[model samples]
Every structure is written in structure tokens, then in C-alpha cells.
Target chain A: MPAPAPIDPRGPRFNQAVLSVALLTGFLVDWRPVVPLFALVLLAGAALGPKYGPFLVFYAKVIRPRLAPPAEMEDPRPPRFAAAVGVVFLTAGALAFAAGHAGLGWALALMVAALAGLSAATGICVGCEIYLVLARRRPVAG
Target chain B: MFMARGVIVIVILFAIALAGRLYRAWRARLQDEKPIHPLVPDSLRAGADRTWVVFTSPYCATCGPVEASLRASDPGARVVKVDATREPHLAESFSIRSAPTVLLADVEGNVTARLVGAQAVDDYVRRPPSGVAG
Candidate 1:
């Protein structure tokens, strides 16, 4: 298989920073509107590549140009996995809110926000880390 | 009241993020100094002066630079790249919780030093394992 293109390590973190804010707002205020927006952003990122994701589009078009080139590029898989994980959480959160389970919705949103905030602040991709750990634990196929 | 709740939630999230960062930093530092715990599998043992046993996954994007860095640092050394996804046992046995983890071992397969991220490649090369004459 052909190798995947490497990406600026900062791009995903930048996307996460934007996501953290949206998620925080959703959790703290009215989650009804924000849930769908969050879910759309995350699902787009997960289904498409990070470059195509809304937040990353902003990062690429605006934020990236203002900053110096990345020190190194990385494979897109981990962050894509992270985006997928975000989709799962946000989807569930949205559903909970729609179902009138406010507490559950808030908890899920909080989890996503916390994970995103960690990545944004420390560049520590917790969802990606979780994906790695799970991939490492799955039984190998013959 | 709603604003206060929001602020409290944000504060809690910040605290959690901070704690996670600190824990990761501590683990990375601790692993760098510690030898490979005895639990690592025998297959990882290498018969080389300084073998670079790198643990990577197909999903980890950072592994490319890490592999490149290891090769550049010690062109002559044998760099063994293990796909943690295929060899999950290796990760479990080594207690490898993250990707791009590199273990430097001596000719006898005794792990000399551990590195837990792509960013630590320079440190590993700069401080080559002890007892090997430069």
C-alpha cells in the first residue's frame, strides 16, 4: 500500500482548540443547537480527512499561513481516529440531549471537551492515545 | 447561576487536562531513565551493540519522523520497527501504552534506555547508553 501523506503536527491540535471552545459552550449553555454543530464537525473530520474538516479548513486557510512551517509532518491516521472518537461522543451527547437526558448529554460533552482541551493545551491527543492502546491490544489476525 | 455552573465546569475540565498532561510528562520522563522492565517479550531482544527497538502502529503518524530520526542518529545500528497493531503482545508485554516508543538495548538485549515519543529522539541519541565507548 502507498504511504499516507504526512501532516503538520500542529494542525490537529489547532482544530482541537476550536472544537474545545464549541464543546465548552455547548456544555455550559444550550446544548441543543451546539450538539448538531459539534457532531457535524466531528463526523466530517472523521469521514473525510482532517484537511477537509471545517475547523482544519480554518486552520489551513488562516492559522497555518500566519505561523512558520511545521517542524515535522505526521501520518494522519491517529488524528483521524481521534476525530472518529469525537464523532462517537458528540453523536451520543446529541442523542442524549434530544432524548431529554440533560445530565447524560452534559457528561458526554464534558468528556469530549476535556479530551479536546488536553490536546489543545498540551498537544496530548488523548483520543488518539486511546486508539493506539486499543489497536495495540486487539488480537492479531493470522 | 448558569454562568457560575459553566465556569465551574470549565475549571474542572482545565484541572483534568492539567492532570493528564502532568501524568503523561511524568511517565515519559520515568520511562526514559528506566531500563526495559523484565516483562518485555524475548522476541524484542536484539543481538547488536545498540539496537533501536521502535514500537509503532499503522495509525500513528509520528512514527515516520521517529524512525527517520533513529536512522539518522545511528546509521550503523540495527533499527527494529515493530508494528504494535500486528504484534499486540509486544506492546502488552513491554507495557507500551503509546506509539513511537523506542527502546535502546545492548548486545545482550538488556534495555539501556527508553524513549516514549518522536520528540525524544535527540535526547536518546545525545545520551547514548553507558558502557559503550564512543
Candidate 2:
């Protein structure tokens, strides 16, 4: 029989990029109260990171026993996903900061990074599911 | 190690960093807003009109060319994109296992074309054949 898919341990700390980009975006768009927000992002990514594995331990905890796992239980996502997240971080952060919003862009980027890390740690890809639900409704969500 | 200790060299490096940052600040521009994610989904075909969906991820570099040409050629065509990594459900509905997958269909709700990987839109537009749904 084919072996069950292994939950790959590591992926790019795309969240770090998200935090940085978020800060950059805020800077480019609006530069008020920048240091604190940007600093928060940097700290979060550095602290709770894309370590050798997730902080939550999906395989041992979420998956093995069976706890309402979603359809994508078989494959946790490719390592390439980290790169894509980075692109989103870089672009969105740059745009938001450049748009003259508050340093909210920095906060937003860090938030995404934290959520992303949380999801990965928990074996739940928030972005993937967000796409799924949105796609279900909108034509372009796909 | 002694070669790196020169103060003038460090000064020049910092100046270049500052210059690069300023350049980007001045030149930053946005592309025409285009969805760059899950390109296709089963539900995207739900509408009465025939549809063509492209499943793409930012990692797949070539999807941009295809999306641009398609929009320029026929603005009315339904070309949806869902970031695959971010939207695994959309990808799942269409059985998307890879990046840059393309799906096409007619008004009847049957898929006509399902192409995986980056495809040159010119080749599709020029020859413009019925896809998997027809």
C-alpha cells in the first residue's frame, strides 16, 4: 500500500517576510508611529517562527487521532507556499504604506504573519481555506 | 577580515542603501489590479455564461502574461484566480494539484479544457479551440 503523506516539517518563514513587508508598506504609504508596529512584526516572526517544525505539532496532535480534519489533511501545502506568502506581504505592505494609511499596514502585515504561523503550527492553512470559502462565492476566488 | 574594517568603505555602502531605498520610494507603482491566485474552480463555472478559469499562484511566474492578454482581448470572459496556497478549497473543488492550471467550459456547465502548468495565451487565442466543455 502507498504510504500516507507525511506532514512536511518546515517551510519558509514567509511570515517574517510578511512582517517586514507590512512594515515597509506602512513606511511607504504613511510613516507615523512606524517604529513600534514594525518592531512588533519583526519580533513575532523572529520569536514564533518557521522553526524545524510548527509550534502546534499537527501530526502528533491534530491529525493522528482524527479531529474533524479538513479535506486537505493529506498534504499540508508545498514549501513553495512560503514564497507566495512573501510576495503577498511585499506587495500589500508596499501598497498600504504608500497609500497614506496609518502605520496600520505594519500591523496588518504582522497580523497576517501571526495568523499564518498559527495556522501552520495548528496544521490549518488559513490562507488556503480563506481562498476556498471566497472562491466558493466569487468567480475569481479561484 | 582587515579589508572590511575600512570606515570609508562602510560609509559608501550605507550611502548606496539609502539611495536604493529612496529610488524605490519615488518609483513605486501598482500593476493593474489583477487577481493572482486560484485561477479556476468548479463553482466559477456555476454562472449561466460559459467560463474559463485559471488556477494560479504567485510562485508561478508566467500566469501574469496569460491574465493580461486575456483581459486585453476579451474583458467579459470570466477568468478567476484564487491563490492556491491560500485557497486550498477552491483548488480542491477543481482537483487542482499544481500551479497554473487552466479550465474552460461552455454555457452547459461541462468543462472543455483543463490545462495544467503555464500556457501561452497567444497560442490559445490565436487558434482558439473549444476547451474541455465545448
Candidate 3:
């Protein structure tokens, strides 16, 4: 199998910033649709690659051109895997909201928001780090 | 009232995040060189001119890259990675609380330099060790 293409390191951070803001807004306004919608976007990104990610596409088109190219690029797989994990949290949170568990829904949603904010601000993607560690644990194919 | 609850969640999470950041910072702060523990196995340093003992954890993003860099920087040095999560006693012997905590030791097994993060590891690697000419 071919290796996945590398990506600009900033692309994931840009997506994280947008995701954090959207999640906070959704929580504050008690919007039921936002979490699931964002979850779908993340799912698409994880399954179909960066071209399918709305914010990543936006970054590539609008933001990336304005800035100087990054000094280093990074493996796209880890961040994409992180997006897949985010989908699980978001889906659970949305389910909680639908089932009238407001507190639980907010708790899960807020955790994702906080993590996304941390990644956006500091480039510390805990979910991505988890992905790398798990990858290391996997047995190599002969 | 619902908006207030949302705000409360945000505030609580914010406080927790701040506490975590401060704790990691405290843990990663610089310290004076210390002696290697006798209990640490002799085999870890047996064959290297300079042995780099790295304490790592499963979830540390920087650990892999730091190990790679350390290996590439010196042909003579050997890196010994200890999984801190699995070997808590070894981690405790050195007071390690952060991942990628690196100890640079000489042939005599005395730790000459201790580094806590990737940036410090890079800086240390860039310079020749204390006795070697740059």
C-alpha cells in the first residue's frame, strides 16, 4: 500500500480552531444540530482524506496562500485518525442531547471543545498522540 | 439557565486545563544533574561511549521524534528507552514526571545532563557533549 500524502502542519490546527469555536457556540446556544453536523464533517475527513474536509479545503485555498509555506510538513494520518475519534465523542454527545441528558451531552461536548482549543492554541493534539502510540503497539506485518 | 450551565461547563474545563498545563510545566522545568540510581540495571549502559536513557510513555507525541533525533545525532551514543508507565519504579528513581525525559550519562554512569522535552533535547544534541570539541 502507498504511504498517505503529507500535509501542511497548520491545516489540522486551522480545522481545530474552527471546530472549537463551533462546538462552544453550539453548547452555549443549545443548538442540537451543530454537534452532529460537525461530526459528519470529521467523519468525511477521516474516511475520504483532506480534500473532503471542509475546513482543510478552506485552509488550503484561502488561508494557506496568504501565509508562507510551513518549515515542516507532517503525517496526515494521525490527525485524520484523531478526527475519527472525535466523531465517536460527538456522536455520543449528540445522542445524549437527544435523550434529554443535557448535562452529559455538555460534558462530552465540552471535553472535545477543550481538546480542540488546546490543539489550536498549542499544537498539542492529544487524540493524535494517542493514535501514534496505538500505531506503535500494532504488530508489524511480515 | 441552560446557557448558564454551558458557561459553567466551560469554566470548569478551563480551570482543569489550566491546572494540567501548570503541572506539566512544573514537571518539565530544568534541574541540576543527578547521580544514576544503583538499582537501574547495569546492562543499560554496558556498550556505549555515551548512553542516553530516555523515559517515555505510550501517549507522549514527542518521544518517538526525540528518540529518532538522539539516535541520528551521535554515531557512538546508544539510546536506552524505558517505558515509564510499565517501569514506574525506574521513573520514580529519577523523579521523572514527564515523557521524553532524557538523561545523558558518561562511561562512569554519572548523569551529566538531564533534559525534559524535545526542545531541550535538540539544544543538547546540537552542542557536543561537555568534553568533546564542537
Give fnat for candidates 1, 2 and onward, in order. Answer: 0.51, 0.00, 0.08
Best by TM-score: 1
Record all residue pairs in model 1 with backbone atoms less than 3 Å apart, i.e. clashing. Answer: A75-B61
Worst 10 residues of 2 chain A by lDDT: A71-80
lDDT of 2 at A65: 60
Least well predicted 10-residue stretch by lDDT in candidate 2 chain B: B27-36
Model 3 bad stretches (over 4 Å): A1-11, A47-51, A60-82, A97-107, A118-142, B1-17, B20-40, B54-73, B79-92, B95-99
Question: Model 2, range B41-106, lDDT digits (tens) per residue?
Answer: 346666636576777764444565566666666566677666666676767766776556676656
lDDT of 1 by residue, A11-122 (tens): 8898887888887776666655786687798888779777668888888888899999876577777788898888888889888888999888877877888888888787
TM-score of the candidate numbered 1? 0.74
True lDDT of residue B3, candidate 2: 46
lDDT of predicted model 3: 0.77
Docking quality level of the chain pair in candidate 2: incorrect
Among residues 3 or more apart in sequence or in different chains, the pairs in candidate 3 whose N, CA or C atoms overlap within 3 Å are none
Against the true structure, candidate 2 reaches a TM-score of 0.32
Superposed Cα RMSD, model 2: 18.2
Can you write out model 2's per-residue Cα lDDT over A1-142, one digit (the tens) per residue?
A: 3222433333232333334344334434444344444443333333443232332233345444664433222223333244344445545655676786535555555455444444433434555555434444553311
